[model samples]
Target: MDRKEMECRLHERFSWLDSLDEQNSVLGLVFCKSGWYNLICEMLTEIEQVYNSKNLQLKSIDLYEIKEKYGTMQTDVGNCIPEVYEIVERYEAKSEGVCEVCGAEGSLHDIDEWLMVRCEKCFHERKRRFYKRGLIT
Candidate 1:
């Protein structure tokens, strides 16, 4: 599914884990490429399982931000146990090998000073576009 669909699904399934005021803001959204959709879903599902097992209350946990940065997934959450953070970190590390453009095996690359994880095909395509745009040689 696309980002919008993924976001909606997350909200529908795990809305209680999110903060109240920020629910409609950009910070509340999952900000990442379509490639990481499955990874994100898996992470959240595990988190939900843990949350339910622990009997956490609605709105007690705050999933502040979910985004990609420095070629890795970054999830910012609040009012939770360390295990939650650990789960997020594990998926974040896994994202390093998954393409940000296409869900394929990939590695980190420096393109026009931007760090991103991309497979060979997506990497070369991005490079070609960058060169054409005078962003890179």
Candidate 2:
């Protein structure tokens, strides 16, 4: 079948998984289409080239386990994985803040100096003093 038809069929068959907002579900549909089949195959082969270029760690897990847990065998296996953006936000929050430039704690400052968000205490001290000097160039 054509890509559009394939996508339509996949979507119709897997509407419930679509409700879960799973990336793999979308990827699976894209991967299975005649039009996207070659593209996604290449994309998967060179996934690192598109994102996470360095230190690529391509791996696969058992779909049967996922099917057993979620009762569907589509790409998402029931859309259980968290969104990438959410995971990144959680990581940032847990990591606290260190200076991106100098690795100083609490020294990171915004351009306007109005917000003193989570930085290390030493970094904040420097930023506060620097703000007073008008030398935060």
Candidate 3:
């Protein structure tokens, strides 16, 4: 899903998120893409109870999916609050190597100049399709 949709759903699930956005619209926690959103959502849902109870608020933090060579990936939480950051780290560690297109086990494959997490079969198929569409040659 897109960032706005993700944020809207997140705000709905946890009303406290809206307050965080109001507090820091500049940062306004945004998820880059599939590489991070689902995992972050799961972690945030789990931690929401404690986070709110402790009166610890998450300011606008940007979580990014870092592209690397096949099989390994990384994410940067950009110096957010310690508690929220810890959850980000946990989910991101898993997402880095997971395929972005399909849920199958994958690695960040470099097809031409593009970076994507795709299994061997999917990677080849995508490359072929891209070539046919003149997106890659």
Candidate 4:
């Protein structure tokens, strides 16, 4: 799944994500790879269930950002319950062992100072690209 397709799925399934399309919206875009698509969807589903169970308005929660940083997933949300935070944290931590490219079992690697999680195949493919670009010798 590409970013646009994944994003469309999220927006379509979660009306609470309405803010993502607005101007001046913080983290207005999904800044991550397709590999983590299922992970993100799962996280959002759990959050939605939590809100539904508690009779909370899902739109009341503001999703500020969702991105990858330092080889893990990160979500910045506002006005959500504690369970939401916990769920995000769990998924973020889990991202460390999942490939950012192909979603296979992976480990964190630093390629020319860029931190990313990748299985051996994706890692080497990225390294090869860098070498070809003269970014690495």
Report the lDDT tens digits of candidate 1 across residue range 62-137: 7877898988889988788888989989999999999987889999999877999999999999999999999886
What's the TM for model 1?
Answer: 0.85
lDDT of 3 by residue, 1-137 (tens): 66566666666775544334454443345535444455556766756655567765644545443333334434454545677666656655676556665556777777777777777778889899989999885
Considering every candidate listed, which one attains the maximal TM-score? 4
**Residue 66, candidate 1: alpha-carbon lDDT:** 82
Q: What are the TM-scores, per candidate, against the unseen true structure? A: 0.85, 0.24, 0.57, 0.90
Models, CA RMSD each: 2.5, 16.9, 5.1, 2.4
Which ten-residue region of model 2 has the weakest summed lDDT? Answer: 64-73
Task: Give the candidates in order of TM-score, highest first.
Answer: 4, 1, 3, 2
- Clashing residue pairs for model 2: 105-120, 105-123, 106-119, 106-120, 106-123, 106-124, 107-123, 107-124
Candidate with the greatest lDDT versus the true structure: 4
lDDT of 2 at 49: 37
Cα error of candidate 4 at position 122, Å: 0.8
lDDT tens digits by residue: candidate 4, 1-137: 77777777778788778655355233355889988888888989999899999999999888877899888889988788899999999999999989988989999999999999999999999999999999998
Tell me the whole-model lDDT of each prediction, alpha carbons only.
0.82, 0.34, 0.59, 0.86
